[model samples]
Target: MTTHDPIPARLAALRTTPTPELKQQWRELFDSEPPPFNRRFLESRLAYRIQELVYGGLKPETIRRLERLGEELDGGDRKKSRIRADLKPIVGTRLIREWQGVEQLVTVTQDGFEWQGRPYQSLSAIARAITGTRWNGWVFFGLKNHRRTA
Candidate 1:
């Protein structure tokens, strides 16, 4: 006895659907404007949203557990958690940037970063040292843009 599952079909259809149609579906399903992301992002998120509508979202207890885990990972700092997960590079990864006429190199380390035989806590500090003015390190290093969504 097999039950008809429309989810797979819906998910598959998203891959071939036109961008405008996908945006329409997103507006209908999410009750908001579609994010200005790539076609692949729209398709994947639409697939997830389709499944979530059919099967429901995470349970409250599960959400609480995840929150607890996130708190533990970031020492109760939400901003730090997001930064660590999204922006922090793996240890030993070398970040290179050229300013003016000289090339700058910074190495990701276990504690923080190492640049020019010196240890620094944050990339912003390194960026400031490289340039006289204040700057957002992620933007300066091209890891992120100035106009971030969240």
Candidate 2:
């Protein structure tokens, strides 16, 4: 059997300005959503609250206090968000738009060609392939590569 405890000690350590009635307020809020927070949408609720806390001129202090409590909390670390579709495919692959503004793909950054911004780590692998003269289009084109080294 498992037992759960009310988050008192953790909340006590984060007492920024006393709101004695705050527990009542929290209880009322919990009464409304008794399922408890365990989803991305639930977390996003606290995200807005935390963002406001940071913007309210308590970012550093909040970070410190939260770090203390986070050491005890299980799911304290935030998850990384996924980039949009446009940036998603291009994360590890270098693509380009031709005169028709279509994305033309290339296997390697060929000689005498110039690139403005860095694509991704795939750039390093492609560069290494080109320099090492082991350039293979079949290996790179539309291939999901996992290199233990690189």
- In model 2, which regions exceed 4 Å deviation? 1-4, 8-39, 44-90, 95-103, 106-150
| Candidate 1 runs further than 4 Å off | 81-84, 96-105, 109-112, 116-124, 127-150
Q: Write the per-residue lDDT of candidate 1 for residues 1-150, one digit (tens) a residue.
A: 999998888899898899999999999999999998999999998888888889999899999999998877668865676674545898899999999999999999866899999999999999999998899988888888899696
Residue 83's lDDT within candidate 1 is 74
RMSD of candidates 1 onward, in order: 4.7, 16.2
Pairs that clash in candidate 2? none
Error of 1 at 53 (Å): 1.2
With candidate 1 superimposed using the best TM-score fit, by how many Å does residue 146's alpha carbon deviate from the native? Answer: 14
In model 2, the worst 10-residue window by lDDT is 79-88
Model 1 TM-score relative to the real fold: 0.67
